[model samples]
Target chain A: MASLIPLTAPDDPRIDAYRVIKERDLVGRGGRFIVEGRTVLDVALSPRNRFTLESLLLAESRIEALAPLLAQAPADLPVYTASQAILDGITGFHIHRGLLGIGLRGAEPSMAELIASLPEEALVVVPLGITNHDNVGGIMRNAAAFGADAALFDFASCDPLYRKAIRVSVGGSLMVPFAREGSAEAILDRLAASGFTLIALSPSGASELSTLARPPRAALLLGAEGPGLAPHILARTLTTRIAMAGNFDSLNVATTSGIALHAMRRTQITPA
Target chain B: MASLIPLTAPDDPRIDAYRVIKERDLVGRGGRFIVEGRTVLDVALSPRNRFTLESLLLAESRIEALAPLLAQAPADLPVYTASQAILDGITGFHIHRGLLGIGLRGAEPSMAELIASLPEEALVVVPLGITNHDNVGGIMRNAAAFGADAALFDFASCDPLYRKAIRVSVGGSLMVPFAREGSAEAILDRLAASGFTLIALSPSGASELSTLARPPRAALLLGAEGPGLAPHILARTLTTRIAMAGNFDSLNVATTSGIALHAMRRTQITPA
Candidate 1:
């Protein structure tokens, strides 16, 4: 079991990483991320995820409830306990959930290295220009929920590891293997070269999603909310649309990812 | 065309409804609600919706840009103009979108009245305990996007007409007809009485979504993120689940609505 280090002073250098968390979230720490809440910490501690927990800071009131979790962590890891006021002082805001952890990103594999390691019948989600952190997180959650082997993001997309994104994803962002590399075209070229069928989601697409047949290996290409997939990207894949009523033509990109991924999963089991 | 009334002071009694909008948004202003931004105001102005506009407030620079919309408004309706600073003072914050409208909810029909009005082959979305305004708004957007005839919300659900919900829905809450009334069981009974097939969405559902055949008249019963549908509600309806991978079982309720609605729409055309 890890040792419980009491933290009475807010300015202690050991807990400096937890200071002004909201501001630090803007200019993210290099190779490190904050995991908040007991539920997310549970995911972070799981051996399946690639994140390594550096330390944990818990509110005194919550330590008793989280004893089992703390007992499982490596003995060398420091577990700190602080009053709610001290915790708030460190985080620069009221953290009602009262559990926080600093985590380091594991070695990130190159896009080629990641893709080559996937199973032969892999399903993946590719996001382009999805700059909203919430959408990126939501997509990761959906990808994990729907059994997508991995997520490939273009450089234009927001970081999936952003604090708010990680929290919103319920830590599914950490569990899902993702790599943000290359331009949209370059990623598309690589996916196509790997014998993956590229399917671009767009409102103007000719084929309805229900009627389109899924390939043995599929990569769903999604874009930002308003502008949707760029014309060049749409041209390079089988363009399919989620049919909508005439009055409203759009769905939030994250929600679109869920529907598209679910549809892809269905097609895999029951061929169209 | 709407007559442009010039407002020189933020404390003007005629514009009292716009004061401290964020706070007023909590209790809400009796039967009235504020609509923000150009996109949402566009939906509020549509003649098909059941909202009646009391007045409009626009930023000075936006007056000329919104001329077409102003021309379509009832001639006697007042369109107020204020400088950005004055608008900010009245709203207790920066009004960056700069367009606002005060709309009165028209007579809300009884649940029976609303359900009875739907077509014989209607598809509906029923949210049981969705207290979050964003989720309610998102569900409304998905309902509108996928052509669900109406939304039926139980008392446990948040007000779909709430300001934040309306904004998050991109005005979808206005375009789609929705009513929050009765308990979950009462609403289910009403729907069943109206010849609608009740299908509850739950993580523990026995049937996969793709395998379930669509009913001619369907009502998708949904719940909040964590608790999902209550046990009794699930027992009363045909429980269905979106087949998820073993690692993660949850999807955001709004995303689930979108996927389920799309699946229902697809099944309507291409029977299982």
Candidate 2:
């Protein structure tokens, strides 16, 4: 079991790494990312989790409820507990979910290396220019739920490790195999080089998802909501649309990904 | 054009109806709900929108950009413009999206009436135990995107008109037809009465979505993410699951609804 350390002050210098989260988010997580809520923490500690949990800071009230999860942590891990008031002061937010931890990102391969490593009959979700944390997290969750082998993010997408994204993903960011970094073209090049059939999702794609042919390797590429896929990107890939009703704008990009990913799995995984 | 009324104070009694939003929410909505952002406002003013745009409170700078939408509102509708600071004060939050409106929900049919009125080829989304506004909004947004005839919500579901729900929905709550009321059994009873084939989605459902046969009228039923549908509830409906990999709990209920709705469309609407 991790060691418990009582904390009376929110300003204790021992927790400086927690404060370094967003800066590391911009510069690269210094190998550290924040996870919030017991639901995510549960995943971060599971055997399948790709990352390592380094430490935890919890509100005094949450300790009992989170005991089973904490009991599974590394014996040497430091568990800091503070009053709810101090916990709020430490996070600088009244909206804290009372459970927070820092996960150490493992040594990761580049987007190119990851794509080249996909197994045959692979299903992959590729997101480009997705800057919304919630959407990024949702896509990650969908990717994991649908059994996609991997999720690749283009340079413009938000970090899935951002606390909000991790929380939204229900720890999917930690559970799924993911690699980020590369321009859209760079990522697309790798996918194509690996003989992956790319399906670019758009509100105005030439064909609907039902018509997409089964490929040995299928990669569904989704872009940000309003801009959707770049025209050139669509031109090079088989562009598919999720049919919708009326003249309203398209579905949320994350929701679109879930639908498309599920469709891909039907052909790739469950070939009924 | 709706006349723009300059507002100098946050406490002005003229916006009392906006103040009554949540209180009205728990009750019958007093026939009034709130919409936020220009995107939703555009839909509220569109010809197909069911609600009446009674008033708008905007950040002073937003008026210029929103003029096109405001021009379409009823000429007598009150358009209040306030500085961002006063707008924040009025909303009691720093996160104000700078656009708020009061929408008058027209006299609506009950859940039974709404379901009973569906066309022969109809699609409906039914959410049970869905209390999160974001999920509620996302479900409604998916409902609109898939061209479902209407969304029917059980009593345990949250209001789709909550300001946050509306914003997350991208105006879908306003664009889509919806009815909320009734217990789980009552709602299910009405769906059966309407001759709707209710497909209750569960992670462990007996059949996969890819194999679901098309019904003349299909209602995709989703439950809260963690608890999902009650066991008794599952026994009554055709239980269907989305194919998945190693168990990751499940996809967000709204995402499940989207994928299911899209799958239904392929069979019900497109008939491919």
Q: Lowest summed-lDDT stretch of 10 residues in model 2 chain B?
A: B19-28
Interface RMSD of 1: 1.0
The superposed Cα distance between candidate 2 and the true structure at residue A137, in angstroms, equals 0.4
Q: Report the Cα interface RMSD of each model, rounded to 1 decimal.
A: 1.0, 1.2
Candidate achieving the largest lDDT: 1
Tens digits of per-residue lDDT for model 2, A98-186: 77788888788778678777887788899999999889999988888878899999878888877778888888888888888979898
- List fnat per candidate, in order: 0.88, 0.88
For candidate 1, write residues B208-264 as lDDT tens digits.
988778888899999888778878788889899899988778799999999999998
Identify the runs in model 1 with alpha carbons over 4 angstroms from their true place. Answer: A269-272, B1-3, B26-29, B64-74, B269-272
DockQ for candidate 2, C-alpha atoms: 0.71
Taking all chains together, each candidate's TM-score versus the true structure is 0.94, 0.89
Query: For candidate 2, what TM-score does chain B get against the true chain B?
Result: 0.90
